[model samples]
Target chain A: MLYLEWVSFLGLLGCGLWIFLKLPIEASQGFPQKIMYLHVPSVITTYLAFFVVFIFSIAYLWKRELVFDQIAKASAEVGLVFCALVLLTGAIWGKPTWGTYWVWDARLTTTLLLFLIFMGYFLLRMSVNDRDKEARLASVLGIIGFLDIPIIHKSVEWWRTLHQPSTLFKVESGQASPSISPELYYPLVASIIVMLVFYIYLLLLRYQTEKRTDRLNQLLADTQD
Target chain B: MKTRTKFVIGGAIIFAVLTALSVQGLQEMTVFFYTPQEVLASPGKFENKTIRIGALVQKGSVEWNAQAIQLSFNITEDGKKFIPVYYAGVKPDLFREGQGVVVEGKMQGPRFEAHQLLVKHSEEYTVETENKKNKEDYYKSIQAQ
Candidate 1:
């Protein structure tokens, strides 16, 4: 845990310096293109965090393990933060380049839906009083909510959207090469790696807190009895 | 009815309405804009209806009326078929010739009058060595454009 914390902070610092100072201004969008490092990394991290939630939710259902549920809950909290970051950063980036902050296009709308579904995930978790019942219901919702990610990802191609298609994941000639130039692409790759490390650190910290909170609640219930 | 049953019924009603509204909205916005060729292909079909057309801003066809606060440009797909567009709005920062744009408005006779103009940035990225290395050069480049 200590090592992850150190690595992520230092990694992020290095990437930040490399991005702002070392990188050249992109041709079309000028300085505003710098937001891509922050925006894209958070987008990838959000996808990964929810993917963790999806996995653990399935594991909890299969094994009926409270630890699985706790892990899923921790990852969901982290995912929600990153998801909000995606929306915020995208909006800030959009104002200059796209000429609008928000559009009701499929990509933007489906992402908003993902955020809302998870908001309801927490609400549903809280509204149910029984611990086991809460886990069961939330796991189901988590599974259902994850189904939106694929649709959100494909919406740009499936529908006409103002948001540009994937730059990093662009596939041409059966090879996976980013449309971004090498000078800018390398730093973006570095930022994404550092962001994932940061995500792992957050997940571990949140999981510890969730575990302790459950233990404390159990202790209080025993004392009251 | 029992309290639990009433609560269930209320929840069901709310869910149904929310689902209906979203489905309707989703259907409407699924196709955000039509290509220039599609509009040209069927002009009478889209005559007065408010629609959005996505195309590249034609080169050297832009005329900005600063005092009147109107921007007029021709949008084209293959450099052959063109539709002249008149917009009354602030010019977006990225608005320039040869860039992709999506305009929302109605077709007025042979010309299109747009209310909203959005720039569609390409996925490709490049670093212009002479144009974008420093702050002054960047400003000069944009000014040159």
Candidate 2:
């Protein structure tokens, strides 16, 4: 299963790279617009990962299952990584376009808050000693942290921000129209798919590692007893 | 009430309060960037408020004094309604006439006191095919049209 996952990951990554390179350079942004392929995909995947964390967290709270908690932890860890990548890519793109590396615009501020919330979630998880109590607390935080996602999504529209409003999904008109050209749009979609697959693969690997650690702890306790 | 019911109600109340607070904050904090026409139509509303306006720089309106680091330009949305903008800073490399720009500042009567000027670069990457025409000739052609 692991081997197959790795092979498919490489295949999807190869496909994504091909599509990304083939995307036409934007007339105004020129080649710098290519960063959008990476930036957009990472953010989308980060949202997906966080959503997984939310679902698993709720499941853990409802069923009180260790497996659900494991899943939530794994997904949140992966989400945090992707969240950092999103910020990194965004800052890199902003420097050339917005003339500033960082701004306190609504979108940027909300995203930073999201990153900090997850960081706090991880810190809380590590600080707690009791397994069940830790899972319960983390579950609550995981659910609340997701509240930032909608705020982040709407920030560009809600505030006076330098960040451009939604280009892929314009909500006001109730239409799913993209503002970008088809050449750029297709590659962006391709990159999102590739990143989603990569996220799921990482989540599974991390979940397996968590299960192994739990089993090892059980074995050690049994030996001591 | 049962413990689960109590918990649910408490969570709902907290969520509602947070949502309300955020909604209120967003309404008060959101400063929408206005076009030149929008600013002109309601100039009284924007007085003393830090806001951003985006428009095309009017041709032949750009004046830069390098010694004082002062740049002045007129921006317009429809070429009929123009707003004079003054800034004292190193201008962006992309600043040019007929280019889209968004300036953040407060309105002082007829002139905008811009604290920051951002050049709105185009997203398209078309190859430059009309490089032979000089800057003045290009400006003249634009004006002639």
Candidate 3:
């Protein structure tokens, strides 16, 4: 985990440099548009993390495995942080491009809903006293949350939309136009890889911490008995 | 296999399907943001294409009809770069001279017409500081000339 942190730190530095220097050159015409790289990728990573939470939640419900339950909880927490980042960065980027921090577009609305749902998921986990019931309820919410992510993603295309279309990976929009130059892409990829590594590392730590806490609680119960 | 294993397998399949579906969905939406200079440089792409252009309003460029239903201005990346903008809707409170804005619409001949205009302003103040800077910059250029 420490190593992952180190890698992520370096990655952040690399990405910062790319964002400041190389991005402006590649996207000479669209200076402010470079925020798409950071914003879009973070959203993608958040979605993937939440998907993990959803999958593990289902697994926990079916198997009733403690490990699966912990995974769900861990991923959901990380997913929430990334989701928050996506919104924050998005709003910042919006200021330059959309002229306002907030809008009532379909995509924006769905994203806010997703953020609230996950926040509620965390709330439910905390309120329930019994661990089993907590996991069960949270898992159900997690599975439901997965359903919303797609709807959030598709809202732009499905309806008359105001939000900008996708930028990074577009098959139908034709070839991959380098919004940012290769100088930036290399660092951007590095940051993503490092973020992924950091995510795995954090999940491991969270699972271990949960396991230790469970052991301690069980021991306490035994002593009382 | 036990019930738990069965559940795990089912979950994995669903996960795979959902991931694939989401990836597929990403294909449909590809949005781009253009600045005023970019739109001016390659005018062809925006002739009838819906595009978003971000820039600061040029001084003395805003014009309004008698009824005030329609307004027009030139947006510039800096003082030197400019793109003509035409909007036929109610502008936001923040739409004014030397204000940062992102106008969304298609290019109508020499003018980049806007259907929806979003006034991009800082939360605290939406004043025209760029005017002072541009004034100084203009004087410096005039001196050089």
Per-residue lDDT over B107-145 for candidate 3, one digit per residue giving the tens place of the 0 to 100 score: 888878788788643211112223233443222211211
DockQ scores for all predicted structures: 0.38, 0.21, 0.07
In model 3, the Cα lDDT at residue A41 comes to 72
Scored by DockQ, the top model is: 1
* Rank by lDDT (best first): 1, 2, 3
TM-scores, in order shown? 0.89, 0.80, 0.62
**lDDT per residue as tens, model 2, B4-106:** 5877788789878977986786664455367777789998999999988877788899999999999999998677889999998888866777776779899
Look at candidate 2 and tell me the lDDT of residue A186: 71
lDDT of each: 0.86, 0.78, 0.69
Residue A151, model 3: lDDT of 84
- Candidate order by decreasing TM-score: 1, 2, 3
Model 3 alpha-carbon miss at residue A67, Å: 0.8
Give candidate 1 misplaced runs (Cα > 4 Å): B1-24, B129-145
Residue A195, candidate 2: alpha-carbon lDDT: 77
- Candidate 3 chain A worst ten-residue window by lDDT: A23-32
Which has the higher lDDT value, candidate number 2 or candidate number 3? 2
Q: Pick the candidate with the highest lDDT.
A: 1
What is model 1's interface RMSD? 8.0
Best by the TM-score measure: 1
